[model samples]
Target: MTAARAWWARIPDPVVDLVVVAVAVVDVLVSLEDSSRLAQAMAALACAALLARRRFPLPVFLLTLPASLMLDIVFAPFAALFTLAERSRDRRLLVVCAVLFAVASATPWPLDDLSSHDRTWTLVYFFYTLATAAAPVLLGQLVQARRDLARRLEEIEEAREHERLLHSQAVLARERAQLAREMHDVVSHQVSLIAVQAGALQVAARDPDFKEGARTIRSLSVDTLDELRHMVTLLRASGGRATELTPQPTLADLHKLVTTSGIDAELTGELPPDVSTTAQRTIYRTVQEALTNVRKHAPGATAVVRLWHADDGDAFGVTVTNTPPARPSLPLPGSRQGLIGLRERAELLDGTFASGPTGEGGYEVTLHIPTQSG
Candidate 1:
């Protein structure tokens, strides 16, 4: 029953009005038992008035009352009453309209022939008709209530979805704040100490080679501390920056990064100036991670940082290759997430990342992104 009503409700308003008018015409024709020309004209007007019931329900209903009184008709007045009941919020007005309909339906026309008993029967019939008139009003009110409920439920669902999104964002912000604190308090402090110790070692060392190594360590430690402070600041900003922070590394900064990597590394090749900031960041991180891996696992290896664009003009990328370690490398703590992260970044840009050992006992990391990717 509910499904059927839903289907019925989906019918267009104009179409429903036409159907009602047609039904009322059929009802009038069925009851038009040799009525006078005036009665016929009133019946036609009542059926026509049903067409405008949705817009002027009260006036249309009043127009139908005269036809109901002079002739035995039902549908035109009922449709108009239902429409008025669906739209009107005044209960008293609805009650009055119902009473009027009942009176029109019960009272006999042409007041020349009447008796006391006939008047009593007419009063009883009026009450019965009043009760019957309540059916359409109640049904129309039910439809109105159902529509209001559906609209209210939609609003509640939207509010809940918005609240859930806000809660998730709050949780993410808290996590970022905690991570920033840990990096600032622990990692930054330790790196600062390493820089200080390396500086002391560089000044005290007698051997030229030892002095150079200490100086390199101090420089790298200082750079790491600078980067750590920047990261901490960004995380603590809670995803909104009050001012422009330090600029991120791009291909232009690649030269400085390769030179300070504490290895015999060479930077080469060039890409289009139009590469997106996100793509540039991805390339920079790829080179940074590749060099870090070489410093830890391939000690004393010479690395070649080559940026290139495909001849077909479809893609551009970088390749970082390192020769085999000249000596055994020291064991370093690592999470092994660098390659996985690089792969994910490439995937996001609809690109490709590959890392493997070369036949010449060297390691190579390559990244290629489409020219259109951002």
Candidate 2:
């Protein structure tokens, strides 16, 4: 049955119609002595009409049914016509074709010479032929329906797979952007600190009282390099592995972060560990970026760093504001990715971050990160 359906699907309607004509011709040849040549010719013509079944099914059925009835009297070969009608999607035409077939099969030709047994056998032959003709048409319809359903299912699966691939690519792009921002923030701040301290070391080359300052500068450089290495390692790890970002600078390191920028600053706050870590990093980077901006574009500007924590233990905030020099002219050093990185870090910990010019000849950055005790 499977193989037959497969074959039927491939066979065009015109080819199937030609096959039906061949079958009709063979039937006429077998019954030539009993049926007239003219009657056989008519049956062949009726079979030929079925070629139009796909394009004009109702007209084909109408022409073939009556012709089948007329030819049945001579050779009783109307069964093929009934089969074509059944294959048609129009069921009303199939019913009409069935009625005509029944009439043609039962009607007796040259009745004067026919006997009772001959009539009964002829009626039985007609009924059997009609049933055989209808079988394939019904089966073809079922097969076509199944093929349609399978095609639709394949399309749906392809669409779903496309959507999944798009979603994965979008996630990967977001992660890459976030990583870029983090690198910019870390590298820019550390480089700015090194530059400022290097200048201080050069100015105090022969002064013993400034030896401690030189040592601090050397220690910060080594620590900065270590942090840079850690960031690089984190970037290399893949497949959702926990990133080994450096032990993030917290409130404890805020003093060093401010002093390294050559900024005279003060800090005050009773900060929780989690909030303090997130806030400290955010503040350090913000202040570092701001002070770097000051040194590059507004040299000789003084800056103030403020740390505030609420006693209710709900929130911690840090603000860094810096004034511009009288002759501010140097272009800002580093890309603007630092503030973006700060905002992303704050958001990752469900915190808030803001930065802008204070409209008082200086820039200000504010960060607030919430904390919970374990």
Candidate 3:
């Protein structure tokens, strides 16, 4: 039944209107036999009026009443009534139109010739016609309701999709904010240290060349810090959630980090003390993120954090490896963006970051960066 209604709805409006007019004309023709010329003229006018029913439903319906009173016919008036019912929302007006249709259908033409018996039959037929008229009104109302329901459903679906998009945008904004905070904490600490050390070297150096180099390093480090601070401030002002910026960890803090980590871990190996402050911070973060992952995904695991430099002192990095978990790990909520941030940090320093499961059912994370001279 629904498929049939859908197919009927697919018909073009003009085509549907033409079909209604044609059907009304046929109804009038069938009723024209043995009718007076005046009745024929009224029937023709009623059929013609149906062509304009969609634009002027009440007027067309009124026109059909004269023919209905003069001749025996059903299509023209019923079609006009259905159109009016579908478009009109006033129940009182629809009821009045239906009653008018019933009366026009029931009344006899040339009223002076009516007998008492005929009058009784006319009253009975009036009730029957009114009852039948309800069919078109009811059907028209159903169509109107169905159309409204479809439009409302479309609106609801669009609203849900819009909500989902907003939620995704909110998540992305939060992630970017967290990234900014991490950058400010780590980068600001390293650059500030560089400026301090350079200033010290510039003051103590005896040779003119060494003094000039130290002065240049101090100036560049200070400028870089200023730019970095401004950028971070802008990011926070735009939309980042309020957060405290704390002192960043460096190589010196590794021992405390490993000891406090919930996992059993060993820290070993050392690099030259002259390694750049930026490099030291990157090594620190690598170990931090790796140990955090072990505690979350590899519970009861023993980890090894090894810091190393190349034989020629041209490159240096840290490697953190953890054995398979000795106990079941608990489910924990995480953003899963720690590694991505680590990778981005490595890229900024022309370094490499890698992490994956080892052959012994363990996990390994490694960071490699070129050494920078102080």
Candidate 4:
């Protein structure tokens, strides 16, 4: 199939015409009478006219028609050979060939001093021969048309498949980015809390309450390490196996997060279970990231976190604010990723999140999430 298609790609109309004319000239020479050289010469010229079929199909037909008519009168048996060379791109050329064939076949000719009945039989034979010679060219045109249509359809399907693959890749890239942001927010908040409690423990080692502070720091560190391990395992697993990891912390876990952050949080609201879960998780992460930001970038600054539910109880909000340290400068290491991850989490749940320096020289982070029932 490949070779045939390659060959067809290189085939110009002129090449087809040349091949046809060459074949017709060979047939004319072998079948025509040698004594009538003038008639043979006319037949050869008529066949040669076919070489210009691509450029001047009508003119070639007009030139060949009279020669064919003369051949039919002079050598009736050999006249059909010229009909094969009539093939051209123009449909009008076929019409000319048909008219010439009919006229040539119907014309009378003197053949070996034959009777009128024998002459009529020879005319019928010539008509049948002309029809047979035209069949292959007509069939070739039909086949070429079908091939062209098939090629176009294949190209369209290939283009559509390529577009679909590109669209799918784009969606997967976006989802992966969102996943990375979520993981960063979750782990960084836990790590920041551990660091702050450890520092406090070191500074207050001479005091009696240092033991209690040290114990708390150790517990928070262990819990954070376990959670981090589970997240890593979940990420590595394939298929349904990943679901074995502990379920994500939701609204019910907000109190634990705030307490671990060493913050006193005030919460008020009666939220639907599903909405409460989503809102609580989003708020918890936001607060965690905000506190981490404060401890690293604004040490010695106290933090406040407030959670509220709307009157209708369909929406909830959280706000975390903290004053800057005595000397404000660049943010803490990994602080940028925390806020970015929190923003992505909020957007995924169709909520709003914002964090920036407040007018009172303090940083404030806020989140609002809508609750939806299962």
Candidate 5:
């Protein structure tokens, strides 16, 4: 039943008016009962005036009133009264239209007849007149009330949905801050200790190869510690001076990032002459994520990083592709959230991201981002 009513509601007003006109025409034809042709035509025309009721309720009601005296179709005045009452919130207009409908519908029956009849019959006719006139206006009022209620309910539901989303975001934010603190307090400290031990070993070792290896480990550990601290600061500050709190790596920093990944990375192309910090950061993260995946999943592979202006200089593009691992090695532990974060970052900028095997048993990640110019 609801589905059917919803479908009916979808019908346009003009189509609804046409359907009503057809029903009114059929009603007039059925009740002809020896009425003159002119009377029938006037009745049909009065019913047709219902189409204009929405646009000009009072004018159409005035048009349909006298025609009711000829054909005596109750609905013509009733429909007009309904429309007038529904369209206006003005009590005076509604009352005036209701009185007009009563007068129009009860015509050809003398008001003085009430005085000649018994009290019982007089009361019956009086109630009948008032009831017929009031029914349409009352129905219109009911419909208006339902519509207002529905609108308010929708608004309240929307507000609730907004509040729920905000609450979820708040909870997620708190959890992220807590996680950042843990990483800094526990994991970063441990890594720094390891780096310090490697530095001590590098200083004391006699063999040049052992010293070189220790120095490499210490350098990598120190870089990791610095990045971890930067991340924690970023999370703690949240909305306040993020870039100032911890510097975000831009395209200019790709050389150092590639070097840290322990892979021979070839970088090409340039960012737009004047790019936004956001676009630059997104581009940097995309490359960073791709490089991290390589180090974790395919540690010994060489990578190629490419950057180019796409879409006629309206957008920037980055491509990172690496060959499969050189030989078997211990798999690096990872939660593998880097690629997902990279994808989300691209989407936030209305950009595109894709990563998959290159059909050569090699993995490739590609990103396209819009620059400030576009």
Candidate 6:
């Protein structure tokens, strides 16, 4: 099917003229014995010119008329008219050409002379002239209509195909989100029970060693719970639920984030309370993604989390820089879209986010969010 389509597409317009030349050429050659050499030469020229009538429709079409001085140009005139009407959108020019051919068709020829006869024969000649001349316009209009209909159908099918692809992507995204919700529910339940048992162990322990172990276990379980909750928040916010609380974090939440992550961090500058909710969420997510990377990829790194407000109070942002980890540890691979998502979020809000390694062998993530109208 594909090969057949390719072959048809490669076939050019001029190929159709070969059949046209054959029909007109036979008429011109048969009249050679009776006509003058000049008349036969002119007829041959007019018929040969029909081969390129589509390329120059009006000029070649006119060449085949009364001025050819021989009756042999034949059906080529009608073919040229069809090509003109099929290709050009100018109705006035087609009408003028049709009128010219009709006028020329009334002239008497040796093969089919009728104008030299009585009233009844003249009427027959004129009827034949108009019928032959009108054939092309009728055929061209039909071809043009079918071509237009085919083009419209192709465009509609292409649009439907694109819509189907997008729907499939949406379905896959929903399935992944459902699976994440189920995993988090089961894991969270187990973690909560561990934390509760560790709390009881801490209360009953007498030996210093056992007391310290119980306390450490409870602390580790609490940190795990926090991380689990953050993951669940992200999953639901993206797909199903938690939309109302998804952007709840503000500039004020950075202090607790730093403490819980066990990073030796320093906080500096004023965090403006009046920042817009969307900008705040982007700001919070930027630091959160950066800190998450630091913990996973740059373990034990000290981070400096800074927030600064513009003097006009219309802009506020945060920058978090973390030193390279003291000792490297193998970290599991993660979805690498965090930085890309942060950049897109910031740009959507007419803000900016920049991240890269610093000269001091640390990674830095910086964001500037414009909150007020200019």
Best by the lDDT measure:
1
Candidate 5 minimal-lDDT segment of 10 residues? 108-117
1-374 per-residue lDDT for model 4 (tens digits): 87987898799866766677667666566657643666667676677766665465556555664556555422222223233333334556564665565566455443347677977886787677567545644664565455544644554465457559967865665564455446656775667678677767766687658866786776777677667656655543321232444355676776776676533344444345445445566776787678766655664467777776678766777788886553323332453777789888888778888888889888888887766521
Off by over 4 Å in 1: 1-6, 239-374
Q: How do all models score by TM-score?
A: 0.62, 0.41, 0.58, 0.38, 0.56, 0.52
Local distance difference test scores for all models: 0.88, 0.61, 0.85, 0.61, 0.75, 0.74
Quote model 1's TM-score: 0.62
Ranking of models by TM-score:
1, 3, 5, 6, 2, 4
Indicate the TM-score of model 3: 0.58
lDDT of 3 by residue, 1-374 (tens): 87997898899998988999899888888888888998998888888888899899999999999899988899999999999988877778889989999999999985677788999999999999999999999888877667655654554465467669978877876776776787699998899999999999999999999999999999999999999887776666443455344344678899999998766999999988887767777888889889978876776689999988899988888999999986445455679799999998898899899999999999999999887632
> Is 4 or 5 the stronger prediction by lDDT?
5
- Candidate 6 per-residue lDDT, tens place, 255-321, comes to 7777775457777776676676677678778877887778666755799888887888777788999
Ranking by lDDT: 1, 3, 5, 6, 2, 4
Please give, for residues 172-274, the per-residue lDDT of candidate 1 as tens digits. 9789878988998999999999999999999999999999999999999999999999889889777433435635667788999999876799999999889
lDDT of 2 by residue, 1-374 (tens): 86987887899877766776677566655645666666667666666665665566556656655445545432223434434543455666665666566666556654456677987887787787667556544565564456545654554465457559978966775685467556657774676578577657857788766766776776777677677656656553432334554356566766777677644454545455555444566766766666655555554467777777778877776777778663324343457786788788778768888887778878778877776421
Tell me the number of clashing residue pairs for each predicted model: 0, 0, 0, 0, 0, 0
Error of 6 at 24 (Å): 2.5
Cα RMSD (angstroms) for every candidate in the order listed: 24.8, 25.6, 25.0, 25.4, 20.5, 19.5
Better of 3 and 5 by TM-score: 3
Regions of model 5 farther than 4 Å from truth = 26-44, 109-126, 233-374
